[model samples]
Target: INFNDIKEWKAALCLLRSSPNLVELEMLARPEEDNLVRPGVSFWAESNQFDCPFDQLRVVRIVDVVGIRPELDFVKFLLANSPSLEKLTVKPVSNDGGLDLLKELVRYRRASIQAEVIYVDP
Candidate 1:
């Protein structure tokens, strides 16, 4: 799955639920400054309740990762749900907050103990 303009969490949740058998998922995004969607809207709001588990998900590659809350939340969601996930490769759009992103993602409690995280600098 390649999410290009995924700005809202509602949309993100819907897309995630639509694909229950994804082996690999990918997204196209830029840096935080050039956010694809408008700022200030929380993607992971409390009112939105979803329990979609990725039963067949394995690899997740998000291009031009910006480490925004929504982006990171999306990653955290996958890590917490995808039991079969093997690897997560993220290529940042810039050096700013790249390390921070890694730190945050690496510490997330992943359902798959074998899940490996890779951060690529551009």
Candidate 2:
């Protein structure tokens, strides 16, 4: 789904929980304002609490992810839940924390899933 607002994100997350046959998910977000600080751990914890239907998911791509805590949580959730996932791609917005985000990705890579992370220099 093309995420334009928080409402869209909420809806998408709900849909992901209900769709039992979901094989692939691609989340694209448009750039916006408001740099509110959200705790990444809480966001990830909440997402992990849900029963996501991603057991069959093989490919997940998140595009245009800004430095938002929710975005980081979302990536972390995908990494943890998508055991069968073969490919995952993330494109982060150019900002002060690009290197930090890359480090997090590297640190979270699963041994079972050969995750390839590419950060576009901006």
Candidate 3:
């Protein structure tokens, strides 16, 4: 699922819950036009934990990742649950990070034996 703002982002999660056979999921994770509101929020996760096991999910590409709590948590969930995941590509909002985000993402426990987390800049 892809979202441009908070409302869309929230709706994306619901869509995610309903998509049991989802093979891939992507989130813009920020306002496409750079709206000042960032750093993420906790309320977006206020829902029942369906823990929808992504049996077919193989790839996840999140653009404009801000490394916020919610984003990080969602990434962790994917890593832990998506047994078929083969790759996770994160393109941050900028070419920053100093490799910190990459390192953190790599530390997550992926259910897939061949899962790889890649960070890119453009």
- The top-ranked prediction according to lDDT is 1
Model 3 regions more than 4 Å off:
1-10, 31-49
Stronger candidate by lDDT (2 vs 3): 3
lDDT at 89 for candidate 1?
A: 91
How many residue-pair clashes does candidate 2 contain? 0
Tell me the deviation in Å of residue 45 in model 1. Answer: 6.4
TM-score of 3: 0.74
Candidate 3 local lDDT, 1-122, one digit each (tens): 33335566567666777888899887677534544335554433443255567788999998888665666667887787788999999988876772778888899888899999989874
Please identify which of the two predictions, 1 or 3, would achieve the higher TM-score against the true structure. Answer: 1
Per-model TM-score on C-alpha atoms: 0.78, 0.73, 0.74
Q: Candidate 3, clashing residue pairs?
A: none
lDDT of 2 at 112: 39
- Top candidate on TM-score is 1
What lDDT does candidate 1 reach at residue 29? Answer: 63
Q: Write the per-residue lDDT of candidate 2 for residues 26-61, one digit (tens) a residue.
A: 777566665333433354547667776377777777
Model 1 lDDT, residue 8, Cα: 47
Local distance difference test values of all predictions, in order: 0.75, 0.66, 0.73
